[model samples]
Target: MDWREQQPYARKQGESFDVKYTGSCYCGAVKFKASSDPVDAKFCHCTGCQSLHGAPMQWAAIFHKKDILFDEDALDNINFYDSENKQNVRHLPCKISCKQCRSPIADEGRNMMLMFPVAFKIDRRNIPHAFKPTCHIFYGQRVADIKDGMPKFEGHKDHSNKIEE
Candidate 1:
């Protein structure tokens, strides 16, 4: 299916509120607006994230699918990749070049879309409040030893009180 075909259900809803944040891709080929406060902002240490960002972890912000706004022309160049397991998640990255200079713009994933905060034209300090990293996965592959201060769990945890039948 196409990226537009796989658009999330939440995006169809009428907006109850609105906020704004600006984002762009690596080469500045893309530019866009996020119209809501991210629900869950954190870092992922999974191998896929590590490989994509060329870093030990990837910073991500989760938003309802409908909140993303982009230039119509930029939409054509989005590149999609199904990483690890196609059954579960996919990554959709933009392939546009900046209007003034050729630079790649941005990328989004199945559950989250990440934009480099440093790329925005405004003062970085005025950016939205960011929370502490909630949980870290792939602890085994972490570049350095896990620190002693943070809470560490053996595997994924379900905090919901609802018991499955």
Candidate 2:
């Protein structure tokens, strides 16, 4: 099975699961709803992520763009910043944040959006198994060492060397 297939939320053919997540910015100016299970979840230790999030790592849940629905206020309350290419922001991948509070939201890719799990309203003790991070990516760039047993990839999962503990 593919690495992603191991995720609890990875449904097989003809199988179905229903889960929803609601979240908003710190100031509550930007709200969103994810009506489906995430495609994947992981702890990212990339330098860009650390710098942008102001932390050593970032936990993000991946979802199809269509699965995420922004509230009507999003049009005016959200801002997109393309850290790689600034010329055509909307046409390329970018980071989405609240215009008022500047809270980091999601990283918008071509088809997937990596939503910051911290923004969601979830019970800390009852987080769903599927929402738990499965691995660490960009481990080589990490500023802090994580001794968790989860797979640690020096770069992108499946595309880079796995760091053995």
Candidate 3:
């Protein structure tokens, strides 16, 4: 069946994830691109994720910051803020958004970025299999239960899972 077909905000026209992909903020005030590096995807249900995305869950894919290309002007229109980590300490800038629209563009760190799939211009039908979300993280904090077959991790993916029998 279709992945995430139940999603509310449908992708914008002309969004496609191919060998290489480009993405932008909701208002197109900022844009960037990444090579087809087979980034892994994750569905996060932590409270931080929920509040940050203003949703119950956040769908994200990992990419090396070096692979992403953006226009200098577009970069100028972006803002940065550090999110408190599990330790409750502010780290490097984590939240990056378009200043014009205040729409989040990505979660950037030293070398990696966790991108929102909706920000990319990819047709649901054309999304690469590798880009498909494989697990639910921080399942313990879910605001609403998701009954998908994917493993539900009680914490991080490498840790234990919460399986209901």
Candidate 4:
């Protein structure tokens, strides 16, 4: 896999601050831009993430369904995989490349879409702010030596704290 970090770019900041984040696939055949900041960002140590990224963990930024815009043809070329029996997360790989070169571009399920920040073409600094791992699932499958410092919960957090809920 190709790994790279481009120079940081300027971004608007503060509550309500918004900016566009641009990204593309390895061959540049697939390109996209999200018009708003990510609602959530985190790293996953699940087996699916490991197998998809071929790494210890995978970094992602979650955006609302409406914020994402992409080339229709390129979007159709995306390859998807239902990695687990739970069928809660769908992996989207670049279709222009072989398995060895295939890279995850997003994860769609649970009514949300997570874009892999590493594939973005924008400056790293312009990327959305990320939050701590709110929770960790499938802990039993995690590496024994991996330290668990973030909050641990069976699933997503309860939004009862929100007044609207």
Candidate 5:
């Protein structure tokens, strides 16, 4: 299926952000920018996220879809993978990554983009002051445990903490 079909969020228009952040892939073949601040930042322990990112959890900064911009030349360097398994398709991320170097770029969901703040061109040590992981989502799916003490939510941290049966 076309990747756009996997995007549940309709592309927003006319929104703007004063502050812009830029990022690139490991090989520098892919680059992008985002505007405004994050709606929320969190650690996602969902199996799909962990598998796509090859990490225990993904640190993501949420932004309105319109706020993200990719350069023209780097357009072809990006690709999407549908992370849908058995759950509703609308609920999973359409994982975006760099084709050349294979860096996990963003997790696109309905209405927003969950990006890796580590990709932002900012000082690494300033991460906490810049973006903070407010909660942990899909903690039940985690392969490993982190003692971060952040509120662990079973479904979506903001929407519901109850585990889905």
Candidate 6:
């Protein structure tokens, strides 16, 4: 099946999508904008996510790599972390963050990027429903128990079994 069919937006060449969200690194040295709503959003409880985010879980939103754009200066101030020494630098997916403030920007995959919701310019008092996480992934690796009613997956979203509360 075509992946775009499962996504929220599919842009054609020459077509444009307006930026719907903007975010910056802690020191404002790096910035990014997302042109469309996320394809998926979830709370990640994987050990890698916990270690990198220094938190129990990470609230992440997924978007097609092309739909998000970083500032021109972002390249100069960003750092990339690759767990594997995959020689294909051009298409290698890795975590990227601001070098100045050490703030995580996003986790870039082959065709998608997982952006942290906390890094966006959101109004704490009135957060949009779109940014809310729909499920908890990697629940088997979680360090804490959450009683929230959201579905908890033992691994990848639809690829794993949903653990009962």
Instruction: Count clashes in each candidate, considering only residues at least 3 apart in sequence or on different chains.
Output: 9, 0, 3, 0, 0, 0
Residue 125 Cα positional deviation in candidate 2, in Å, after optimal superposition: 2.3
Q: Which stretches of candidate 3 lie over 4 Å from their true place?
A: 1-19, 85-93
TM-score against native, each model: 0.60, 0.85, 0.79, 0.61, 0.77, 0.85
lDDT of 1 by residue, 1-165 (tens): 555444431233464425376666555455566676666555555676576667886555556556666544555544444443442223444212354443433345544555444444446556557523455555444565556454333322233221121
The list of candidate 5 runs beyond 4 A from truth reads 1-19, 85-93, 128-130, 162-165
C-alpha displacement of 80 in model 3, angstroms? 0.2
Candidate RMSDs in order = 7.1, 7.8, 10.1, 10.5, 5.3, 5.3
Shift of residue 85 alpha carbon in model 6, Å: 3.6
What's the lDDT for candidate 5? 0.72
Q: Judged by lDDT against the true structure, how good is candidate 4?
A: 0.53
- Please give me the total number of clashing residue pairs in predicted model 3: 3
TM-score of model number 6? 0.85
List model 2 lDDT by residue over 14-132, tens digit each. 64434488888999998887878788999999999999888999999999876777765565777878787764244447788888999998888877889988888888788877689
Candidate 4: worst-modelled 10 consecutive residues by lDDT? 1-10
Model 6: per-residue Cα lDDT over 83-123, one tens digit each: 57733232347777788999988887877989988888989
Scored against the true structure, residue 64 in model 1 reaches a CA lDDT of 55
Q: Report the lDDT of model 2 for residue 113.
A: 87
Worst 10 residues of 2 by lDDT: 2-11
What residue pairs are clashing in model 5?
none
- Candidate 2: lDDT of 163? 96
Tell me the lDDT of candidate 3. 0.72
Could you give candidate 5's per-residue lDDT for residues 1-165 as a string of tens digits? Answer: 543323222223554434467888878887877766778898888887776777888888888777777665776787767666643233445777788998887877767888888888878776745478888888888887777667888778868664432
The TM-score between candidate 5 and the true structure equals: 0.77
Worst 10 residues of 3 by lDDT: 1-10
Question: Model 3, range 1-165, lDDT digits (tens) per residue?
Answer: 231121111223564433388778989988777766536898999998898889999998888665565654575676767766533222554677788988877776666778888888888887777679988999989988898889888888878767551
